[model samples]
Target: MATKFKPFDVVIARYLLKPNEVFHLSKPLMYGAKINTGFGSINHDDIIGKPLRSIVFGDKDKKHKYIVTRARLPEYVINVKREAQPIYPVDASLIVQAADINVSYPTLKSVDDTEIYKEIDIFRRRGYKLAKNKRNDIKNDSSSINKKEEIIQEKLLILHGPINSYNGKTITRCSTPPLQFLECGTGHGSLTLQICKSIHASNCYFDGINDLSRGSIIHSLDRNLKHMKIGISTVSGFQKGIYLDDVEFHYEPIGPSNWVNSDIANYYRQLCDTTEFLQGCFLDMPSPEHEFTELSKYLTVDGFIIVFTPSISQIWDCYTFVKDNDLKLTLVSTFELLTGGNGGMREWDVRRVMIRNSEMVGKVVKPRIGVRIVGGGFIGIFRKIP
Candidate 1:
């Protein structure tokens, strides 16, 4: 099918002359600007409105040939320049899948099986005669039907991509896309952007303010003012260029104890109480267990709680805390591994715990995939339980 490239749409251009290099650009391309490639210069306007994957020869000389395609989530994530390390696609895929971000199946099968049978039965009862040519056309359209199914699957899987930092030591924890979510310790805002995308895809609203009435809002906290500013700026850049606007950043130092009386904490409490409590809470800090008491207050019944720490000692401490507070939370899964290969290595031990809300048991969270350990860190999966 021919697809028209529209203004402001992101496009990925691959130059045939330089097979290894790829260029990402926005549409409504500047007419006069020359994109200098290894072989020759190509005008931006030459590729605009062209069907994706169509080859556009360079400057009529045809010395440098180029092909344009719609930019996918992975391409956008990889091509977007960042000061802080962004989450790699491999790790990001795992996190998104675990959260059940884009898991969906088509309804065509049900329509074909049940609806078609009902139609056939009705037609037979009515003694209706079907056109022979129409029946032949349906048979001939089987290939097109399969193609439509493929398109549906492609649309469902289009948004699968990474969220943020994966240092082998500091893994960002996640849950099934949450309507009300909290991110403690925003580092560089890589994951924040991913979360924003998730919220946006889910059609949730984020106003960057503590508005309890909003559909979805992410409250990102960081102790370091400088780092918080950087994170904010990073997300702002995304908002301006990539259009991510659902994440709110705060420079409040959140500790298990200190945040209970802070203004932000109070704001969070009001936000939670007004709109059913937080659907997910991701804790990326030195000692996440310290803040569990305060964190649990904001969590909704059957909400997800994910904690990431580099130290095994910290994991053990958090485990013990969950054990002691059996009524409030439970230990779900622990992922630990050490591996090295491909000129890279990783050593990580992380734990995932869930709130014990009693209403969540038997509810299916995404199943945990076995860790291959090609990389260093492993993620633990957990769900809130009664």
Candidate 2:
């Protein structure tokens, strides 16, 4: 909806190759602010205020022109330099959809700490769904408890609340409710970026919260610092960081059984005790079950546990581990993405294609380990077993 490209905006330039067809240029319209988009070498100065998707000539001869525009969420993920494999737009979409995510437009007036979280004799209370129309809901929200959220006992550490800093680290943040989701992997940030797009409209309406709030407060963790650094920027660089404020990237090895006892979780618990719960928990890291017992402890009664695995055995390992440990969760669904990584093309066949190795031969009865859970792997969805 923006009319012109703003400063520091990462723009996408798509050139028409033939009738009714266009393809993006290899070089992005950023960095030193100069990029040659096949038409002509574009200058940082010439693009500062240009209208998006409009024809811009590469030369004064006006021979090569491109329809320049802002990069959409999907385009940015594919084109960005990745340190690790991305979740692919296909897998990311399935994760978001299966989680039943709902977002509201963020309001400009920040939440007044006095007005929202006055009771820290206590922890933060969860927010309720008031109305879709954010423009009017915040103003007349005083008389509505009919739809108030059931305050659960699970607690979340408020990253913004007044508390002793984490080992003396600064806690410069705005007060808000406990975040809704947690992800253990921050590989290439492809899925993280996609999640940002979904929750963009409904967070950070309050003043001084995340100065760049876009309706999300995701805690994305990766043990690899290189991957974490890329994720932080890959997501922050989009749209001049329109969704940058939504995610909090942390570098931590989050998959041990003792993970709940880690310094980070302990530090959080010391500040705000057990009233915050994550609505959704995602695992894309190696051996997610190692963190399953500890992380799933923070889920609201029926919060979800979603895992993306290249091997079906991973999910099986997760399910058995949770059950064996009695982790209060139940498998809700399991799906195979036929063309999951081959872009977003979904194939539902009559005879129907199946996982790569659906069976084992000669009485060995092994699942042919590493066969993509049947040609496309699997997504395991679970719900907190109340």
Candidate 3:
């Protein structure tokens, strides 16, 4: 039997408009009654059970063919809708490596198996098919009324979870992150997804998010209500919520106003939870300096915080804030990213502050390069020192 496209999988459609022009559009494969691609329209009935990477829809004449294929992470990230300016895929990729996040699988034991089965049962009751598994061989019996596929479906009666390419159609990585990470500014939640993908291995297929002390995760925070909601919705919609549980969204900033009065923080404090604290932090907001002090408190020793500033001057402000506040943090690496050109990133020289014995003990400055060339941003990597 040919593999099929599920209602919620993000997919890509490509065709040649002219001999030299290739056009591509990426969208979630909803059980959409009909999808208008401008090039043409593909009916839901025609596409649901067709083989992938095949021309399932389009102007099928010799002159034009619309090819449908699965969208890769980078492709999906760039092409997906934006709630705010996205952290370009180029930058997001590097941030993962720099963070050295742990996404190891089978890290946590199953919390509850039967409780999960109920949700699966509910998912099946709604009448959605789980993509057939070769091993388990999930069968459909309309008249005989056989066992139902046990995953979630959207309100529209569309299978909105994952299309089980992995053996078990019933698996969901509902565990919290095995390691804690903070994305200070959840702009469009793009980088949050990148980090989750990096550490997803630390999780296994189970259903439901656990309020565990330590699990693999990236906690994304944004103040913009619309952007925050969109970020969560966009991520949850991907591949049917694969990384959705891996990320937890927050409206609280780490600063005094939010965390100081936050019941969430009080809960962590009541438990005396230092071991489950942040392993890494990424800042992609204006005035990231405001976050450093509070972030320092929960950041485990030797944990790293990476800040993204559009200008070198803001980096200086971060440096000044750290030094003046006597925060036990060090500026470890400075990178200048080329934004509009090739998404290139290069190490830039920092002219000040090598802290030793909690003192600014060094001064080295080189002439600025390309004074007028606006790169994507400057990134400062800081480490929490004992």
Best candidate (score: lDDT):
3
lDDT of 3 by residue, 178-203 (tens): 46677876768778888888877665
Instruction: Provide the lDDT at 349 for model 2.
Output: 13
Which ten-residue region of model 3 has the weakest summed lDDT? 147-156
Off by over 4 Å in 1: 1-3, 17-43, 56-61, 100-178, 201-213, 223-243, 253-268, 271-276, 309-314, 324-327, 336-376, 381-386
Report the CA-based lDDT of candidate 2 relative to the real structure. 0.58
Question: Cα deviation of 39 in candidate 3 (Å)?
Answer: 2.9
Lowest summed lDDT window (length 10), candidate 1: 122-131
Each model's total of backbone clashes: 3, 16, 17
Q: TM-score for every candidate vs. truth?
A: 0.56, 0.68, 0.72
- TM match of model 2 to true structure: 0.68
- Local distance difference test, each candidate: 0.50, 0.58, 0.62
Can you give the lDDT of residue 157 in candidate 3? 33
Total backbone clashes of candidate 3, pairs 3 or more residues apart or in separate chains:
17
lDDT of 1 by residue, 104-190 (tens): 211111123233222221111011111112222212233433343333223222221223212232211111222567776666666
